[model samples]
Target: MAETKGLGYELIWKFDMPTTINHIMIMEDIQYGELIRKYKVEGKVNGEWRILTEGESVEHKRIQKFDKVEVRGIR
Candidate 1:
């Protein structure tokens, strides 16, 4: 996948039946790197990660410093 210009952290997401464990909810069939639905991401989640073919809407965040990312999620 193409790297985002300002991606704070690299997360390996997995998909399932939308599991909510420890207050963290993960949607079904939604895998980015190592996370679930609604994550703190920078840049556009398309072109690079083609999760949605057309008319796709991804949730990404524009972060400045990597330190802002409290958790690394995964390697």
Candidate 2:
């Protein structure tokens, strides 16, 4: 994916059934320099969107671990 240049972007994944999420990983193509300076990982919990983790920056990769949550979708 390409940078949005301040417009920002969002990507989502949906499962056929609720799946327990323990952690997430995000990566940037460092060959072009890290463009992602901030990001958030959220999960759909109990029909509501809840922030699972957030960060200030991500270079080549970032991994976030959190208490397992069951959800049907994530973004």
- Give the top-scoring candidate (TM-score): 2
Window of ten residues with lowest summed lDDT in model 1 = 46-55
TM-score of every model? 0.18, 0.86
Q: Give the clashing residue pairs of candidate 2, or none.
A: none
TM value for model 1: 0.18
* Overall lDDT per candidate, in order of appearance: 0.29, 0.82
Question: Which pairs clash inside model 1?
Answer: 11-33, 11-34, 12-33, 12-34, 13-33, 13-34, 13-35, 41-61
Error of 1 at 39 (Å): 12
9-67: candidate 1 lDDT, tens digit per residue = 34454322222222222233335542433443322231133221112223342222322
Cand. 1 Cα-lDDT: 0.29
Per-residue alpha-carbon lDDT of model 2 for 8-73, expressed as tens digits? 388877677788989999988889777898888888888888999999788888999999999877
Residue 9 Cα positional deviation in candidate 2, in Å, after optimal superposition? 0.6
